[model samples]
Target: MTDRKLALAAWESLFRAQHEVFHDMLADFDGTDISQAEYDVMLTVTRSPDMTARLRDITANMLISQPSVSRLVDRMVTNGLVTKCADPDDGRGSLITATDAGARAFRAVATVHGRSIAERMSALDDDELRTLRALSDKLRRS
Candidate 1:
């Protein structure tokens, strides 16, 4: 049986930790060409084949509303960070592809952000990191 009080306490701790860590990590984008949202969109796009991904897929991965993602994509398009075109396979959908400049910018910020993440998470050893990953995955799946 679950202990209700303990569960709430654990949830609060987890929430606070995630919030603080994320807040600290935002500094990784300081003075960079892209904001954190752009980095997130490119993170999904650059991982897909040919630096391309479906708009729906990007929206699904984002924490923001679909409309917000759409607007951000439009801005990225205006800035020449990416190209968006109607998806041939899905008439109502679109495809987003990172431009050469976009990929370069993502890479530059990723390097610094990756290092910052490592430094911050270094508080946990490899085994703890693995355990945390497993737990987080399990929770998401549940």
Candidate 2:
């Protein structure tokens, strides 16, 4: 193969391996009784620092439908991980918020999952880590 073709093949293989690694990390997260989808929502909500997110915003960020967002929020609330409340700014709309319990659970999951990931990547030296980050950023931009 040409040099460019060989490089492209290596990138594809690494990307697939990265996907598998993510799948493994998500296999056991129980925070909010969340699937990968719900946990993603939770992360976005919690990071916003407003302590709340609109249903529409969540749907947009999650790339899900309104009905699907509602269902996911309902399930999380039932599991004591989230709360759904009418938006004060617009009573017709709703917002989703994570409870204290939800934050705690998310933290716990992050701890375990982060440790597993760190351990796995520990073998890579600092230069390898930098290369990985640069490649990830490049792919994301592309």
Candidate 3:
């Protein structure tokens, strides 16, 4: 049996916590060459083999709409942070690859961002983190 009141309370707490944490973490991007969105895009791209990823894959991983991702990718390309080209296998799709400059920028911000995340998450113990991860994953899956 599920308690509706309890569930709603839990959801409200979770949402508020996430919002606050995200807001605080926004500082990590300040003075960086790339915005958070660009970092997110490159996070997907650099993780892929050869530092390349399908545009569709990037779009899938992002929270923004497909058209927004396309526009952002174009801006990234113009800034020389990444290269974009038509996908070889999918004529209608595109591929995004991080340029050397882009990779460097990502690494720099990632180092600072990783530290910031660790510091913030230190509020929870390792076991709590594992539990949080599991619960978050379960929610996403559901």
TM-score top scorer:
1
The whole-model lDDT of each prediction reads: 0.98, 0.80, 0.98
TM-score of each: 0.98, 0.71, 0.98
Candidate 3 TM-score, C-alpha based = 0.98
Residue 104's lDDT in candidate 2: 78
24, model 3: CA deviation in Å?
0.3
Candidate 3 has an lDDT of 0.98
Residues 1-142, candidate 3: write the lDDT tens digits.
Answer: 8899999999999999999999999999999999999999999999999999999999999999999999999999999999999998999999999999999999999999999999999999999999999999999999
- Which residue segments of model 3 deviate by more than 4 Å? none
In candidate 1, what residue range of length 10 has the lowest lDDT sum? 25-34
Task: List the candidate numbers ranked by TM-score, top first.
Answer: 1, 3, 2
> Once model 3 is optimally superposed onto the true structure by TM-score, how far is the C-alpha of residue 29 displaced, in angstroms?
0.9
RMSD of candidate 3 to the truth, in angstroms, is 0.7
